[model samples]
Target chain A: MHTRAKLALSLTAVSTVLGLMIGVQYRQTSATAALGLGYLRGTVDTHTLTELKNLKASNQAAEQELTQLNDELNQFERVSSGSDKAMTAFQQRLTDERILAGITAVEGPGISVTLSDGASNGSDVEQILTHDWNVRSVINELFTAGAEAVSINGYRVVATSGVFCSGPVVRVNNHRLGAPFTIEAIGDPETLKSALDIQGGILDVLRMQGLNVTVPQIKQKIVMSAYTGSLPGSPTYSLNEAIPSLSNNGT
Target chain B: MIWLPILGLLIGAAVGLVSNWTIPVEYSSYLSIAILAALDTVFGGIRANLEKTFDDVVFLTGFFTNIFVAALLAFIGVQLGVDLYLAAVVAFGVRLFQNIAVIRRLVVTQIRAKRRRRFNTTS
Candidate 1:
């Protein structure tokens, strides 16, 4: 009876170990079968599965980084193109400044006035000759009539230009010019001619003096040369650092 | 009396299920071979008991030694890159069937002899 008891005990111990192993195997097989990977469970293990998962995660991360970099690149391109537009606008402003400074040639519809020395009519010599004042008066009247540009004897008239009487010739822009002075002004042709043809204006006065002055002739287009003379040298002036009030006004 | 070991096996199986213990995949093959060896020894022990040749020391030692040797053989087969576990499985399977057959025949003969004795007493 003791031997039988021992045999039962030993057999139970062995069966218990077998049962444990079978239970674990069943659990593993069932898990794989639930995933529809029962056929591959024997070949693939946890280590390979984890490695594959890690690889997939890294691939996703790399794709995200690539998209981020692509977005940054697009932003840089947009910014550069915006800067290019600003550069073109700045260049356009510079061209306008050059035109306003009278350093660039201009063309438009305008009128021309010619004055010459007339045959003496027993009057004073000044009355029979075209004088500097006559040219100055005509230029001033043209400007008042809203002339966009003006020239005399092919010389551009800028703000700093001087017209003076020198001997028998007229000195304009520091150059000597004789009779038959042609003053060209660019503006509305009718307005420029009407400004000079006003009753008892400069044209009528010049005509009364016997100084052979012709009526202002209108033209479809008059091309005037640019200012050829050198601009005034820049003065050796330092920045006005003392003007604190005006400094703050600069936005 | 004969149901004692079967009861013990069912109880052990229930305990294994309740414990939820599991082995790693690497050692599962060795466990399978060991289980096969244990099953063969159990059946062989039953046959010996029926034939009146059962020894306590031999049965107990054979039970443990068979399990250990089967697992060791499987481990060595893995090291040697051979299918030696299949050979162990075949050997244990054949012995298990043979032992079960002998047990079945012995139990039937014992039952028949008991019936014959009863009939003679009644007559």
Candidate 2:
């Protein structure tokens, strides 16, 4: 074949192959993405279930302890009443319980900043999942905003809960989260908003990443759990009596 | 054409089926092309180095695309009220079949062309 003819044939071949390759690449990537997302989504669902289950278990345990403490206090008060400072310990325990159970959705004033995917400029089908500025970054910002506690998608943030990615999905305390990450906080809403919207603040960071952010107040409630960790129960979570199962597995 | 991406998808599915049958995986998840590259080199399946490039592309596609499909599945699966994993498996299977069929046709066409070319020159 002549040079031009050969070039044309080669070009045609390359073009056809690349075209075909790219098409399948996109579809397969999308499918694989779906699979990963599905797995991650399942992980999130599992985490949510775990969260609820463990929290419930903790609540029950805490409640039992609180009831016992309260009974002891009633007896102590009836027996003697001069100075019941000893009850302070009991009261603190109950407070900790409420905070840990995530029943304490703080409501005074707070801010909500939304971070969208940074890849908006790219094609919708472009293979991108976790942006550099992810949910954890936002969570950090809220903490900086003097957020007493925070929650995303009803899953409360606790001291122990870590934020990171698990296969294209951001996990908080092992809870898989999708986009439009809702962050609830308990603080002075205006002040919090001010800190976030300042010239060189969280909003700026969000914009740099090409993510959309909006700060709003929780006119009603912001239930931020003190923590969302494992507890004794389920096939996965077993904080208290987890050793028995582990031992059984070994056996 | 727009169908190009579709063709790539089919090729990926072919990779999945071929790898699934020949390659042993406990979880059934694909080996990334990076890993497959090594496996191919180690086993030295004839012309595997060249083939690994293709498998790697397909494997990467499979890994990455699953995430997107998972998100969509979760969003839509809410309507059906089934668990997300089940929904995802169904979606993955459908994509697999679609991918396999397209690549099979492409390969057959290549073979037919080659045969016709040989016969014509001889005649």
Candidate 3:
């Protein structure tokens, strides 16, 4: 072949190789970009899946802890309810005191008061909702009417239990409770019902504030759960033993 | 010679489009560097041909060597925890641009000379 033809053939071969490489490189780069995007999405999915797994593990651990605690309580109850007469008497008195102190769950014929937010028709929003004081007044009235035990929304009302408003919700024993508050009191059903429904009383006051109050005549079974919160420390006071002289009392 | 090269380019492109070949992601960086180096050589060949200093042996040798050296540099950079492929890209990119600029100027000057000759003949 002539030198010109040889050169032409060689140039053609080189251009062919160049073009092939460029095409392949273009396809490869695009594929790499796509692969990189998929990898990023996979990383996010992996992280979310790992977080969900961790939450499930923690929930399982908490359930196990609750079961262990329940087993311990059952064992204590079994031992306390043994066959010795004197032990039985002591156990009875202990249970009675626990019920009176709101430390034990009690169930009997009593009153169930359901308080709910009223309709807001151009009325103040606060007036429509039951507040902390409303719950406290109802509880006080029930106790004065010889209530044996009381609970608001399953939270047993004890001596140290506090009822206060935290934003739109009422907190009993530091647990947040929302309206349709079911206040259950174990007592003489007729007496408790009459005490709450008396003219110009707690029920009337609640009604005046535009709250929806429902007092069923007498629930056959009203259950009040034991208080689950720790009691606050009592206030310490120094003793004043000195007696006053009668001479100062004349003035 | 030019027509042969163009024909070869079309054939290569057709082959590339029809084939289902793929390179792995890990080697794509090296391939990209090699492509850049090859591009620089191809443009350099075109410039050499225009300047009447074109040599087939030199063009072929430079094409293979540039791709090899660029790919090797990228591999070494990966092992050394450095992005040495970026250096190859910059070098090849600058050379490619310079060659393109020279080619454009040459083509433009040739067109203007041809136009001037036509005008002289018409007048």
Candidate 4:
């Protein structure tokens, strides 16, 4: 009888353990199964689905409109190119001027300067990052060194282009750019290198400020994209006429 | 003897219900196979008790060995990239059904015999 009681007790203990394991397994499996089912069914409603479809359709329409505009531009170019000899010559000069003004994409042998943030090493964060002034200074040096055309972070440095610090980032031509900034300039490689590397130049100034500046490396061919922002319309009046000098008028 | 298994089952369920601890998903498959093996042993134990041949040592050892061997098989099956746990499931399932069938027969016979004795006494 005692042995029989012992047997019952042991069986009870084992069964309890078995029950616990079974309960836990059942709960986990069901939980995972429900999650899997939820994912399979998804949570998107008809409204969201319709919105997505409409967005895709509008994107396709916009793309078609762009293609149509490009075609019209090409046709105008072709007609202008085949007109009178004098007109053709004027068009050629206009194209050359456009290239010089960075209104058109230019490709030629040039040098690229890459500037990245320097290691902080527990120092001031501001000193370790490339600032707007650093980018502007680099562009100034490149132009002074006879760089035919220059672009900073893919934004062409045209007459009206502005680079300024906005909070933690640098804004160029109204577009925000972060490190590392790749400055590509099309010019005589040797002249650009010598001008940038002159003793106590912009590079040394940037390096002293704890910014990681790469020495300009000459590339066999560099392609720069044209400025995409709208340019100011031609002035209506001649600048040769002197404006009436403004005097302090009593309010 | 009859109430012992029921008490064991109730205790086991209580312990399982009260504990919030859980095994990871990766080991759930092994746990499932162990559960199936254990259920088989429980049914086998009940059937043995009904037949007056139940042994405490055999029941206890069977419970542990069944879970260990089933888990090990599942682990090895995973290592070999094979569904070996299915085999354990099928085997345990077949035996479980067989044990339940016998238990059912034993219960029905015992009921019929009691009814016969009562009928004879009343007549």
Candidate 5:
């Protein structure tokens, strides 16, 4: 009886260790699994389901709309190709400028930029969330300003890296990363940094916003993986492109 | 992805804040112990919660079949980089499918065994 009881306890302890190890591995990879059931429980209401269904219908409708849009774009392209000589040159020049400023899609080995800033001080623990937009917005801005690739701390922002504020900590890829955020981006550091410091850039905006934004150009060769721009035809965003309102603002 | 993390954060914050404020200096040793215990408990909860959704082994299906959908998604956003939310959504969906597939196989096997037993008895 004593031996049997001891074995049972040992099994329990072993099971606990196995369970915890499974949990750690799961946390390291499928962080969403931990977070998924919660989201399904929370936001997946009948109303939300209906909205999603409607959105799906709209997206299907958009296929037709997209064909029409493509037709229109083709027409415009043809028209422009025929008559807008100077416009073409100007557009080419703009592309050149984007490339020059390091905002163009690039493939090479270079620096990776990781950005992190937690709410330094809040009246309560509610404020310390490391995933502050005050920080991520800056980090995303770093990318837009031609960061070759940026990871928040160690979490690689591969399509699935969750970047959001949780309490006072910011979760990157569901990994709770801390401050003194290290960002490594692969590119010409000089041009990339300039994109941020350029008049009315992200750094300038960050400085105005009163959050610290630092750019450390490294001497070590930064290796950037090739062709990491959004899939072709995906929406292209310029740094601070929305500064000029999408439509008339006064109205 | 958003909800669990948010809930965890709120609860964690509550635990962290509550302990700091309520733990008295006279019981400082107890306070430290309590904090450690509370943290471990929450950590365990988070782990259990995750296992419900993601199976880490899915990444190793030999043919990448397990993570194929996720890889496709990652590929789609490779240009602008992958969207974190989309990755989470895809990963969760794939994992759910994996779990369901397991259950389906198990149920089918059980039904086949019962059928075989019935056949044997009838014969």
Candidate 6:
């Protein structure tokens, strides 16, 4: 009887500790859930998580440096071009070129298209998941329909931007992106929507392939952020050299 | 009398919930493995008591040692780029099931013996 009492007492002690830890673990998981990172629970590779944090920090630093350099350049240009008609005209042309180069944030009427993976119910897994080609084709159709500016997952689509598959994720402007892909295009909303919505078009093809493709959502005003990635530092072809040959042709 | 241990478990859980204390996310795996080890030890203790083999020193020491050794193995596994924690998980999981099975059979036999005693006296 004494031994029985002792056994019960010891078991109770051990159980208490177990219950406490289980409670703590439950609370910790829910805390992560509150941060929207609950899905990462056991699936998150700590190595990659740390790497992502470091990369984000460096990217932020680079953006700040770029902004500072741009401000200095703009101040110099404003001071030098003051009270000079030719210089002001040149400045205006430079601004227009910057807009076209996608280095400047643009805002106008356009459409936003969202594409996501379909249900993976005992079918071709490849057909259900969104791929790089799907994103590229959508952007191409939008541009052909008069989209002046386009962006995928907030990464501005510049002339040199490459879209390709990177394992399970899609790489846009060398940044890995996952679904749902939000492609924002600044253009005539009605025209862009109609172009993508045409019968047997790219959107229809994707829908047929068991992908979730949103009919282009027309917005009265949508803002596309500037491309922050590095660009070519030096140009091999100079516009100054081409001007001389143009003048000769005119003569 | 059996409810005593269960009440203690509820009290501990309540204290943990109210405290709002938690370890870092990275250490959660280690903690979970440790919890599994503790549970295995607790069930093993119950089975030992039912079988007349319960030892206070062994039960208490086993509870702490199991938790510590399991967590240590997991930490080392992380450093060695191995899943050694899985070994702990499998070992403890199997033992936990065995202990529970023994405890269930012992309880059922005890209940049967009591019923038989009552029938014999009434007859």
Give lDDT tens digits, candidate 4, residues B37-79.
9999988988998898888889889988999999999899999
Q: Which stretches of candidate 2 lie over 4 Å from their true place?
A: A1-82, A85-108, A122-133, A218-220, A224-228, A231-251, B1-123
Instruction: Identify the CAPRI category of the predicted complex in candidate 6.
Output: medium
Estimate the TM-score of every prediction: 0.42, 0.36, 0.42, 0.44, 0.28, 0.44
Looking at model 4, the pairs that clash are: A12-B8, A16-B12
Q: Per-residue alpha-carbon lDDT of model 4 for A1-251, expressed as tens digits?
A: 88668767877777778878876776777676666643444434545788999999987886686567556645555555556674456556756777777767899989998999999989898898988899999999999988888998778888888989898888988999888999999999999988888889989889988999898899989889988776664221211111121011100
After superposition, which runs of candidate 5 have C-alpha atoms over 4 Å from their true positions? A1-53, A83-134, A137-163, A167-169, A172-180, A185-215, A218-251, B1-123
lDDT tens digits by residue: candidate 1, A165-195: 9998898888999989999999899999999
DockQ in order: 0.22, 0.02, 0.38, 0.40, 0.01, 0.54
* Model 3 C-alpha lDDT per residue in residues A103-216, reported as the tens digit of each score: 557889998989998999997987788888988999999999999898888889988888999998999988999988888889899999999999999999999999999965
Q: Write the per-residue lDDT of candidate 6 for residues A1-251, one digit (tens) a residue.
A: 88878887988898899889988888887888766587666545765789899999987886687667556655655555555665556557765676667877889999999999999879999999999999999999988998889999889998888999999999998899999999999988999999999999999999999999887899999988888776764231333343354334333
Sorted into a CAPRI-style docking class, model 4 comes out as: acceptable
Tens digit per residue, CA lDDT, model 6, B45-94: 98888898999999999999999999999999999999999999999999
Which prediction has more favorable DockQ, 1 or 2?
1
Better of 3 and 4 by TM-score: 4
lDDT for model 2 comes to: 0.53
Residue B2 shift from truth in candidate 2, angstroms: 99
CAPRI-style docking class of model 1 based on DockQ: incorrect
Question: How would you order the candidates by TM-score, starting with the best?
Answer: 6, 4, 3, 1, 2, 5
Ranking by DockQ: 6, 4, 3, 1, 2, 5
Q: Which 10 residues in a row give candidate 6 chain A its minimum summed lDDT?
A: A234-243
Question: DockQ score of candidate 5?
Answer: 0.01
lDDT string, candidate 5, B1-123, tens digits: 234334444454444433423322333322222223323333333333234432223212211342344334444554566464365454555554565556566667779999999999999
The per-prediction i-RMS, to one decimal, reads 2.3, 11.1, 1.6, 2.0, 14.8, 0.8
Candidate 1 CA-lDDT value: 0.78
Cα lDDT computed for each candidate against the true fold = 0.78, 0.53, 0.80, 0.80, 0.47, 0.85
Which DockQ value does candidate 4 get? 0.40
Q: Model 5 Cα displacement at A119 (Å)?
A: 17
lDDT of 5 by residue, A7-75 (tens): 334333333433433333334233333445435565457558899999999878866765676566445
> What does candidate 1's lDDT look like per residue over B1-123, in tens digits?
456667767766676566657676678778778878888888888888889888867887898899899999988889999988988999999999999999999999999999999999999
